[model samples]
Target: MEHRQSFWENLVVVAIALVLIQTFLDDFAVVAGWAWAPREVLLYAGLALDVFFSVEFLTRLYFSFIRRRTGIYFWHERGWIDLLASLPLVLLSSGPAALALWSGSTIALGRASLLNVLKVVKAIRIARVLRLLRLLKVFARIRNTDSTMAQRHVAKVATLSVTVLIATVMLLGIAFSVFDVPSLETAYQSRITTLLAAVEGDLDRGAPIDAGELAARESSLLAVQREGRTLFSRFDSDYYARQVGPNDYGFAERGDFRLFFDLRPVNRDQSRNNLIYFAIIVVTIGALLFAYSPHFALTVTDPLHVMTRGITEANYSLEVKVPRLYRDDEVFELARAYNEHYLPMKDRRSAASADGFDLSMDDVQGLLDD
Candidate 1:
């Protein structure tokens, strides 16, 4: 049967096109450093796509069962692709980052292991890129072409996409970490300086130093030590200037007494910055993958699909029409050759068969070669 497009199918294609547009806009907002509110709205729109696709998959399964082709659809017809792409990717990607933000947890010494586990969880957002495979299935349906060929091409493209994405994310992750070091160090120094001046001012006024009162006044101070002994400590064990790194310690000395502050608020700020950076990466890469996937169909798979289908269905003549937009391409050239040469030769052989003409073996070979 000749390929034909239906109105409802065309409507679905339009919807997919709009979804791709939304994905691009979301990425643009992230790259442009727009406010979070609009970016978030764009992100929630993805949930609707997830729900839409889930329903579409269910509908496909229903038809596959009616046609007794469930196995064929599940494997050969790319039903697995549909199932994977239909997942609630927006929620899956956002949930970990949201938890990181809401928990207000830090990668301080005691919590480092827990934060590492959460970072691993945040990596699940990378799977969101798999949603782009739906573009291949849409092209297959729109063009009435074989899904397997498009699936093969899409797999190759997807591998390249994932490689580039992972590399980009790793480089950015490293960049954020390195750049954060200086800012964190400066913040710690400023906080320490301010607290030291406050304590010294109190001492100059002939006030007795009270470690407990100082710690209560300073939120960043987890503990305060004096004269090589614990004066006041928030945790069970005393955290001294020597026990932790220089960035997590500040000290003051006055003649015979030495005072130490257990400084770790800078570490908390670093963890929050890392979470924000991770969220930005996920949004940008997901948008880019969705925006570019359709171009693969237009330039590569769609034309190949039309040419291969035309050739396969050429029993008497070429019935599938080559898309006019591909006129300058090799696929169009193949279609032209099939129409101008192969069909005429086929017609001649058919006439010979009807007329009882005993053609030579060479003539039969020539006809087959055409």
Candidate 2:
């Protein structure tokens, strides 16, 4: 049972770390226009992790009730934070259900406005920031464990670095959303208008321009083009001269003047969507670092320091017991070994002193005589 519990705990830790990393990469994919397949896979993996976390949380609560430790568990563990952290996943999964119900029902202010409001409410997924509280809980648990002052300081520094990195990423993402998107949108619109005017001028002059030439010209335009929808010029031999189409079209025949503007919303929405993912990614990373730093310090740094201190004090004829670690791991085993050796050596030293065996001169003179 103990081993099984340990396995689950380790699995949870690994899952949390993986999810944090996956979320960050998923955000990068959104901003970089990478393929969606890997991002979708990560999303499903995150959902699976969320399910595991939810089950773990409920299992803890159930055991707490059964053991009559509800008060102590809630007070010390702050189990409420776990519930808050899990809420985003639950709410996100239920969004479609809520939307479907809203769609089927009638609202006094019209379904369009109500649907918009519901869509905004879906942003509640941002509440995933509450997951950071779980990190704080982990930090607290680590601090309460047997660890040296040096280890605690190292953990603090690591946690601070992670926090700063997260803040920097969020700021950079916000700047991209606020400035870069608008500037790009403006440039794209300008390009579209320029192309339209050039085609129009050619049509006015009755220039014999083929549809293929126009398409080739468009292909030569800048690469940072807006995605989703685009505006272009088309030519149709049967249509009136200089006629603009409402939708995108293929190249036109020679002397057919057709312009089509792909009308879609600006890139602001795309940027905002990217920013949302960025926030989620940053928060998850920060939380994971905060939670893991202390564990790392205790496991890797604390035991060595304790052993060093014990040896140093022993040189001064002062017996120093190695501090016992709360974790029953390799570090604890090392501490136990040190104590085992120290106790026997200490007893031998005491026995020698009680027998009045002065090692300075008398013992040396006796050995020489023999």
Candidate 3:
């Protein structure tokens, strides 16, 4: 039988894909100049997409399950993801708190659950979203598996790896925060209280306050609050010079004292480089692996996303993968070197764009020769 692709199914995939992209790839600054109108509206589109997917997934699942036998074959691999991406939203109105709890737990798992929701996130161009493609591939493989054992094992590994990784990261963050937050919090609270008390006696206190005491009091409070504000909030020089200032939250964004913040290896630029690198790794391995073909349809890589417009490397990718997929030679060498330069090609191409993309001409020529 010819396979029929459902409209809802396509949207199901897109919805999750969008979520992944938005969560991950950031420009480090607001994306101001994109063609999108009233940009915040686009964010609302996400919520709408989520709602549509939820309804579609449920209606399909409900009726399909009633017709058990055919539904087993017709619905096939993605039922679980559809269910997962769908249910949480439905639970929202009925049980908003439950939904919040669910989201919290899922986010705590990091890439694991994110990878699944990301499959539905749509064409979000953000780079971080591409990382979840690896997770989606695993889901696809298990879903396409012919036998119970194959699907079961794939399921097991995906679950085990995701659960373990998320649990580890979550616990570590919690433990570190728990262990380290107190000193900073204590410093913040103590400083603020001291400053507040002194200010209150002079200013916030009842009517007959002395004007001179107000100046001295203000000065003292400014100094104290300045210290508090600088630690957790934005730097305030005058406030620091004075005593009481701001009640601000942290000594430094709450996590500053953690070892991860203290000893984190990647600088901001390097962090961007790592994400670009990770995107390459996940997207490459996810698609290239003939292993994942069954469950989810692999999104073909766009050569355009691989290269910056002026970069010599961008021109090279156009030559290799453009018409014919995969090539070798001087152009091929260039493409290979492109991947080889900083990190593997596997890590670079994470997200897709609607603009038409083509492979390099030389690679196309090589393919025709073969």
Best model number under TM-score: 2
Q: How big is the positional error of residue 309 in model 3, measured in Å on the Cα after superposition?
A: 50
Candidate 3 per-residue lDDT over residues 136-208, each given as its tens digit: 5345533443445445545554544543443454355345434544533234334434533453554435534
Full ranking by lDDT: 1, 2, 3
Each model's lDDT comes to: 0.54, 0.48, 0.38
Q: Per-residue lDDT of 1-370 in model 1, one digit per residue for the tens? A: 1233366566567767766556456445544544446655655576666667777788889989999999999987678777766754544643433443347442232112422332333344334444554554444443322455544555445444544554565555545444544555455555655666677787688778788877777666665656577777766643332234333344455533455555444434443443454344445444434454455555566655655654444343443355678666776576667667766776676677653334557878977888
**Deviation of model 3 at 119, angstroms:** 29
**By TM-score, how accurate is candidate 2?**
0.42
What is the alpha-carbon lDDT of model 1 when measured against the actual structure?
0.54
Q: Pull out the clashing pairs in model 2.
A: 231-262, 235-252
Instruction: List model 2 lDDT by residue over 1-370, tens digit each.
Output: 9999999887867766765565456445545544435544555565666666677778888999999998766655556655645555555643332443436431111212422332233233233333443443344344433455543554455445544544454455445434544443345445555665676677689775454555666542311111322333343333312221111111211123433332212222333554564465455545444555555555656566666765654332333334455546776677677667864675577577653333556658888888
Choose 1 or 2, whichever is better by lDDT.
1
Q: What stretches of model 1 exceed 4 Å from their correct place?
A: 1-8, 88-91, 94-114, 117-121, 141-370
Q: Which pairs of residues clash in candidate 1, taking residues 3 or more apart in a chain or in different chains?
A: none
